[model samples]
Target chain A: MTLYFMTFILFCIGMYALVVKKNLVKKIIGLVIIENAVNLFLILVGFRFDAEAPILEEGMGKMVAFVDPLPQAMILTSIVIGLGVVALLVAIAIRIYEKYGTFDISQIRELRG
Target chain B: MIELHIILFFMILAALIAVEMRGLLNSVIALGAVGMGLVLQFLLLRAPDLAIVQLVVEILILILLIRATVKLDRPSESTLKENWAYVLCLLLFAGVFLWFGYRALEGLPLFGAPEMNVSDYYISNAMEQTGAANIVTSILLDFRAYDTLGEVTVLFTSIVGAIAVLRKIGRKQ
Candidate 1:
């Protein structure tokens, strides 16, 4: 339970950075941190104490317990998604810097209407 | 459990340093440390698959971030003040989220409990159904194949988009 709360706190810290930071790269870092926190939370939620990895070995006896594999699969997908998003974000940031000549969010107000 | 907590503490500390650091290179390195901590936590949680994926992804992200920021000038200090209004708003949001999150968590099973019906089915029958020893691979490739397909598509689209954007930069130069 404490671990869960700590993960949430980490997530909130990421949220603070994402919402308040001015640098585009810092915001991207925050976004990745939040993604990781949530992934960690999900993996933690599915953990089983004293459980073995979710693999069935040949000639093994009937298993009474194995760690949950569903969340692992889901998190795999999510991690890949995060990778794609981060790559794209960095690309966009590079282009933005090329155009605006700065990485500050406040100064890139051309879209503000 | 104590070990887990220690790892979490370091993870959070790394995140804080990453967010507060002035140099982009140092910040990126801090974030990579946080990712390493997370990979360790995943291993401690009995998720070797996740740990492997996280390790590779973290390396990839670190490379991308360093490549993107290497030639760029150091970012100017932000002028946005950390005022009371920001703190109050963040506190309110955190309070509401933690309250509701705790409430929701209470209704669910505790850590390390086999309480999820769907997961139970998958764990019990995956080997027999798919003839795959690794339950995670079976779940990803056999049971939830459509989702995997969609994820691949998403990845491909992002790669194309990144190439296009970077190509534009080259053309402009």
Candidate 2:
């Protein structure tokens, strides 16, 4: 409920910045927001109230009171992927600044083709 | 019933506000919030895959922004008649989108809910084909390997692009 709306709002906001903003940084921010909103949405979708972490105890035959473990694993993978993207993006940004002499995306108007 | 929608309304308002704000960094931060929110939604819907992708993309994007902004300065809040006019046009655009949204939800998502219950289908027979406890992986990589291949290609393209971009810089330096 509250979570769903928040996620959507985040997505729309990111889209807006990506579309409307001329600053490269702002647009990047917009991209980040979009990514976060989607991640949050995914997490929220799988949540179950009062469910414990999916941990199996010794001599416990698949205890029934456990939250799904898949999401947690997915989150870990997502975090790793995010790190990779961030590193690549940062490298790109550094190069763009050196070449363009500015971070204002509107001014990086060399690409007309 | 109405609680979720009401919250969504507020969130939309916030998103619009962030977009309208002139501060580039602030807008980007707002965008991060949006990404986090998406992950939450993915979790709620039991879709961890989507959430993970979102998180990874967000991190990369944020780094790109910060790096890109190292030499850039924020634009001044200069008022212009055309800008306001454009803003008005955007408002109109939002109105159109709202109408479309309403229309979309009218019969959406579950055009034929009973017949297309993917969860049920996966649960009942996924083990037979892939023998993995995680049905999603089997569906994504085995039952639907094409989609997975597409995803891998997209990532591959990005990695290659990044490498090319970096190599050009090395040559210039």
Candidate 3:
């Protein structure tokens, strides 16, 4: 229970860093932290105490030993998506840095509307 | 377990606020954070399929963000309170939504009987009807193919928009 709340706090902290901090790398890192926190939370959601892999074979009938496999499968997809988003964001970050010569974010100026 | 989701929700809201601040990088990070929290929420709701779809979209968004940032200079911070009234109005709208959400969540009925679930209808026959082991795939590609087609069309349109916007940059690079 406490762990769950702590994870949430970690997420909030990451957001704070991403929001209030001016460093580009730190902002990216904060984004990573946020993504990781969510991934952790998802894992925790499907977690069952002392549970085994979800695969069911012969002689496992009526056995309550398996945790859910659905979340893991979903997590796999999410991880892939996270990779893509991270890559795109990083690429954009690099471009912004080149154009503005600074990562302070407040210094970059072209996007309106 | 429930507490976990509530905390993630708070985290998401905070991240949203953070992104709305004066830094472009911070806003991008906040966007990612919101995505993360949304993934967690999907997991809690037992909808892994939606989580995966959203996750994939986030990756593309990150790429687009990075591309734009690299191509253009960052916007200068405007300290002037230009949108205070709009922000206040948005806050009032959010309050209404929050109250509505609270009421909806509180009124959810308990489900103890599997026989009462409409999903059971699909659970038993989805594979047979759609020839897909993944229920989400079956529903997406079979039962809801029209909507899926629409989504694909939207994707194609976005790709066109990207090309149109980046054509000049492509020539330079």
Among these predictions, the greatest TM-score belongs to 1
Better of 2 and 3 by TM-score: 2
Question: Candidate 3, after superposition: displacement of residue A42 in Å?
Answer: 16
Error of 2 at A33 (Å): 4.4
Ranking by DockQ: 1, 2, 3
lDDT of 1 by residue, B1-173 (tens): 89999999999999999999878888899999999999999889888888899999999999999987888855464344455677689889989998888888788678777566798899888878999999999999999999999999999999999989888454745
Tens-digit lDDT track of model 2 for B44-64: 444555556666666666556
Tens-digit lDDT string for candidate 3 (A14-38):
6655555555655665676676666
Residue B56 shift from truth in candidate 3, angstroms: 3.2
Candidate 1 lDDT, A1-81, residue by residue in tens: 888888998999899888878788889999999998999998898888888888888887776688889999999999999
Segments of candidate 1 deviating more than 4 angstroms = A110-113, B75-84, B169-173
Give interface RMSD, per candidate. 1.4, 6.1, 8.3
Please list the residue runs of candidate 2 whose C-alpha ends up more than 4 Å from where it truly belongs after superposition.
A1-12, A31-96, A105-113, B1-23, B48-57, B70-82, B109-115, B168-173
Q: What C-alpha lDDT do the candidate models reach, one value each?
A: 0.88, 0.54, 0.55
- For every candidate in turn, the CA RMSD to the true structure comes to 2.2, 6.0, 8.2
- DockQ (0 to 1) for model 3: 0.09
Counted clashes in each candidate structure: 0, 44, 15
